[model samples]
Each structure stands twice: as structure tokens, then as C-alpha cells.
Target: MIDISQLNYSSADFWQQLTHLLAWEGVSDAAVTETVRNILADVKKRGDAAVVEYSCRFDRLNVSTMAELEIPLNRAQAALNNIPVVQRQALEQAAERVRRYHEHQKQDSWQYTEADGTVLGQQVTPLDRAGLYVPGGKAAYPSSVLMNALPAKVAGVKELIMVVPTPDGEVNELVLAAAAIAGVDRIFAVGGAQAVAALAYGTETIPQVDKIVGPGNIFVATAKGMVFGTVGIDMIAGPSEILVICDGKTDPDWIAMDLFSQAEHDEDAQSILVSPDADFLRRVSESIEKLLPTMERQEIITTSLNSRGALIQVADLDEAIEVANFIAAEHLELSVDDPAEMAKKIRHAGAIFMGRYTPEALGDYCAGPNHVLPTSRTARFSSPLGVYDFQKRSSLIQVSAEGAQPLGKIASVLARGESLTAHARSAEYRLKS
Candidate 1:
């Protein structure tokens, strides 16, 4: 079968082996970086002209102007109406669920008054506009539209612009339908580094957005990284990752298929299974061998499993959690007897699929949680794409006459200690005589 790596947690070099397996060079190479840098500069300088040129050159379109590149609202609505009834219903239901779920995450402005009558608080407000990038053409990800757009709408963003590349003039109706249902303000059939540049720096037609969310290829990722300071980004996501902590209770076939789910995403995607039962680990291996050949993306799954996948034999479930924390995978599944209890100890993971019944695929589509999660080890520090990502907070501070003296003295002292005469004087002026 499949030549997936097997390791033991008790081995002295287990940590080193895990580190090597988890390592993925996400940074763009110099050539790709330079190409993205040039694209950003060109698009920023020439506006729609550069975007149009790149779109035609890269996407194999012959469109002459940016106006031809935009998908009209009527067309988007038509897509929603023309699609299969079941698909439309599914999109609507998913959109509603995503909207409802993110509604709870919406931050509200709040203030509190001190005893001295000073006011301090946070003012929360949505962004003016946000740009979303969808890998288009043959990439039929209506879920991406729902996941990225609904949160911004829930946060009350005034406008949302969507960019999806239609390579070879092929368009995905479901993506358009999702855009219509999610209330995307604008749709542009342009993608890649040029689309990112057009979003970062406003063009003749595409308005620059306050932030950009969604996923793309290496070129798009590099462009996002380069233009980060100019606008906000969700995260520079890595390959898909899934780590399953099984206590040998779940079906071996189910576990094998679950690992295959993420591995099928790409050849670089990673899948790992940790368990205390050596016999169960062997059973899962057998399941992978028997089940992989039946998969549609068998070649991709094979390559991914051969290159990055692992079936680790841990000392026990406790050690499994320890290894899970060290990995900080993008998606984690607790397929054990006490999933809830094991989940309570999980300190790092982009999303935790608790219980054997809860599959990670649900979260990817209609689980009422945004599937746009922090990949790689970023789960340790970052979070999933949520309404909060589309909103900003401003600290509120007000000082009464009685409160000014004490605050002013504190500020003056800090400013003077830093050797800033103007800053110290500005605060000192508010001090009582």
C-alpha cells in the first residue's frame, strides 16, 4: 500500500521527527515574490488597465476593459434562480446558519464611567468595505462565498467586493449564486496577484477595500503578504491539516476516510492519526490501503499520504493530546470515548471536531462555523475568520476636570522620563495649578 510514515511517541527522537514532518516552507520563493511585487506595482500605477491586461494574459480572456470584467447583479441573481432547486436551498440554509452563528460574535460598543467621572470604553464598528478573493473557474467553492461574505455582512460592513477568476471564460454558477445570497456588493471576474493589487490600491472601477479575506494560489498569497500593511488580511494560510486523536474506539475505515478527506485537498496536505492501540493503528493502515483505491482523488490522496501523512502510535490518550498540542493542526478530531473531556485539554487547534459523529467536513460547509481557519501552526496564535475580523475597535477615553489632574501627572511623568519635552508639557498643561 500506501507508504505512510509510522512513529512511536516513546521514541527519544519523536519530537524531532514530528517537527520535520510538520515543516512546510510557506514563504514564496524569490522569483514568485518578485513577480507578485511587479504585478502589485503595475496594477497600482495603471489601475484598471493593468488589471485588465493581466486578466486577459493570465486567465485567457480577451476582455478589453474593466467594465466587461464585472459580473452584473442581474446575472448574479439569475444564477441563484437558475441553479438546481436543491443547491439553491442548500446555499440559502448554509448562508442563514453562517449568518446566525456569526451574529453572536458581533462586538458592540460599550463604555464605563469611573468614580472620578472619567469615561473609558471601546467603540466597535464594521469596516467600510472588504475584498474577498475566490479561486474561480473550475474551483466550485460556493462555501467560500458563504463563509467569507456572510460574516462581513453580519458585522454590518457597508460594502463587499468579490473577485473570482474565470479561467478560459468558465464561470461557476454556484459561486455566483452564493454571492447573490450572501449580499456581496460587487463581483469582478478577475483574480490572481493583479486582483489583489486592484483591491489594495483602488482602480478606475474596483474600489480599494479596508480588508481582504478568502484564499488563493501562491501568487495570490504572496500578493496578500506584500500588501498587508496597506490593508488587513485574514492570514497567510498553509496547506490543509487534520490531526485525529483516536482511542481505538472509532471504526478504522471511518478514521482512514477522514484522514483521506484532507489529504485529497492537495499533495502537500497533511493527515495524522494518534492512538494508543497498536492493533488499531495496524487496522487503520489496512483500511487506508483498502479504501484509498476507491477514492476519486486517489492519486492526490496517495501522494499526500506518502509525503506528509503519519499514523503515530502514542503511549496513551494523554500522550496523544500532548502530541496534538505540539502539532497545532488546522483541524483536530477527538474520536475517543471522552471526546468532550479530551477537547477541554486542547490548547491549540483551528477547529476541534468533537465526537466520532462530528466530521471536519461539516465545519467546512454548513456546520454554522466559518471554515476560513488559521492553517499551519498559526492556530496557536490566530483564530478563525469571524465577524470580529471585519470589525474594528476604537478605545474611548474622556476626562472630567477632577480626573484630569491625576491622569495628566501620570502622563507627564511617563513623557518626561522618555525625554519628550512637548509630550510632557502637553500633559502638564492639564495639571491643577
Candidate 2:
């Protein structure tokens, strides 16, 4: 049912084919940046009034005051109580796992004293407040609430503010329930560039946040890009991605559905399968045809596969690793025999789903690793969202009189070489008798 591109490692044009597939055509055009610029400027100037007006115009919600947009704790708690028992249990379990995993990632402050009495180390501290932006237009992502807020909480963030748009005043109880479970300090019923501006610039009702984290639409991404220097932001994530390296041992249907999991995200998301078994590649393609009709988002998956997906035939697992490293996919699943051994060869990937039993969907939800990962080959240099992202490090230094004797000379030499007389004099003044 899908017409995904097929490539073989031995082909002369394989590199060109791969490069063409990797290209991202959605450059933020001048019109989008101009619109984002206008929104940011308007929100900055008018504050709460501009935010309310934009919400009314875009979300179709007629509200006059900021208090009407503030969601109370009782409402979030009520949502938590109203959800189905099974869903609640699953959410609690996932939260517990995510919390447990992140607790290990928490950094601590330490220092060491040298013989000359110089003390140097790093002091780790959490941000004062964090803003979370969860997409609420098409489908609600409660997992996002757990993923973004829990890490901030674990990192000792003083306060957490969450913003989810209620289009037409329709709020998703699952999202509220997850926010309640995640311990979000405050909740706002606004979204898009207006919400981002509020968090970046601080409106009358919404306090400014030190960093904003989560996923959003193109407009929200643009706003985050524009306001990054004002307030820290998580990466401007591209479309979801999943790359599977199969050794032809796992079920072809599982591989087909694994690809579908990310492809179903949107028409532009990418899904790739690299395998040594050429016949297995054909079988998986047939499985794709057989199973594509059963999916609810069949149209999206089909387009994504046909446009951005690929089934590559490599000579061996080693060559597959080479291709995967070059791609630096957002989600890489190793459906091979010795996944741990194969993983040592991979240097670039946002997250690695080890072994055939592990699927990328588990990581998206209950697997305890952050689903907010690097995309567009940024995995080559970037990392996943974690407790460390919400925390900062300050270099600590204290030079005793004896210690300054040697350090002052070095500082003076460096400062004079750079022609900074004020710095050289300052260091010279610290020299010991």
C-alpha cells in the first residue's frame, strides 16, 4: 500500500539516495518569522491583553480576564480522580519509573582543596522556575507532562508552570490528570506563540520561566527560536524519527509496526529499516502493505513512508551500523542478536532501543528515558532531555594568599599578553609578599 524508497548498499547512487532522503525542506520562511515577530512584539508590549486577544482569535475562546485562564488545583485533582482505573494505574507506574530513572541523573556540588589552599569545583543548582508547553490541538500527550515536568521536579526546580491550549474551551482530562500526577506548580489554559511569549517575557498572570521545555507546532517552534536568548529553551525538535537495524531475526510484522509508530506521528516524520537480509526487506515491505490498511492514521503513515521512509539492504550488520551512524536518527532500535555488542559500534543516536523486545514506543512512555530527543541529525552533537537540562553548574574558586603567588603571575602574564592593563594590574595586586 506504501511506495517507500528502496536502496542497496552496493548501489553506486546509494549515498546520493540517502542524502536526498535526509534533506529537510521546511526552512522557516520569511512569512513565518514575520508572523512570529509580530506576535512576540504584540505580546511583549500588551502583556496579558495581547495574550488573551490572541487566545480568543486563535483558540476561539472568549475570555476577558487572566483569572479565567488560570487552572486551579482542584480541577487537576478532579481530572486525576475521574480517569479510568487502568489508565490511572498506568500513568502512576510510568511516572514512578521516570522519576526513579531521573533521580540517578541528579548532579551534586563538590570541591577539592589543593596543597596551596586553592579550592575549585562545580556547584550544581536548579533553575528557579520552568515552563512546559504541551501540544493540545490534535491529540493530548499526557506523557509529555510526565516527561517534561518530572525531570524539572527531580532537578529541584523551585516551580513548574505548564501551558496547554483549550481550543473552544475543551480541556483534555488526561492531560490535566498527568499534570496533577507530575506535580506541576501552576497550569494555564493558553498555548502557541502567545503562551511562549508570556513565559519568556512574563505577563500579568504568567510568571517568567528560566527555561521552557516541550514540543509544539511550527509557530511555537518559531517563537521558541526567537526568544531563546531571553529564556533558555529545549531544542527546536524536528519531526519524530525511528530507525530500526534488524538482523532478520525478529518478526517482520513487529518491524513493520515499529516503523508505523513514528510514521503515524505526521506526514513528514521519518522511518527507516536497515537489514542484511535482502529477502527480509521484501517481506517487511509486504507486511507494510498487509498492515497499512488496519491503522487509523493510515494516510499519514503511507505518506511518511513513501516520502521520508526507506528500507535499505546492507551487506552486513557492520555496514548497517555505518549507515545508522551517518543518519544519526532520533530513535534507533537494534533488533539484532547481540544488540549490546552492536550498540558499542554506534556513536550517534538520540536513544537506543536495545534488543528485539524493546520498541521505541516504550521509550516514548514508560521506558524512563526522555522522548524529547534530538532530531534532524542533531544527535551527532546533542542529547536527550534530562535532569541536567534543568540544572546549571557554576565554577567555584577560592585562592589563598600562598595560592595567589603562583596564579597571580600566570594571570598577569596572560592579561598583559592580551593587552588588558586593568586585568594585569588586578592580578598584580593579588600577588603575595
lDDT of 1 at 385: 94
Q: Cα lDDT of all candidates, in order?
A: 0.94, 0.95
lDDT of 2 at 233: 99
What 10-residue stretch in candidate 2 is worst by lDDT?
A: 24-33
lDDT of 2: 0.95
lDDT of 1 by residue, 191-214 (tens): 999999999999999999999999
lDDT of 2 by residue, 280-366 (tens): 999999999999999999999999999999999999999999999999999999999899999999999999999999999999999
After superposition, the stretches of candidate 1 with alpha carbons farther than 4 Å from their true spots are none
- Best-performing candidate as measured by lDDT: 2
Give candidate 2 misplaced runs (Cα > 4 Å): none
Task: Give the total clashing residue pairs for model 1.
Answer: 0
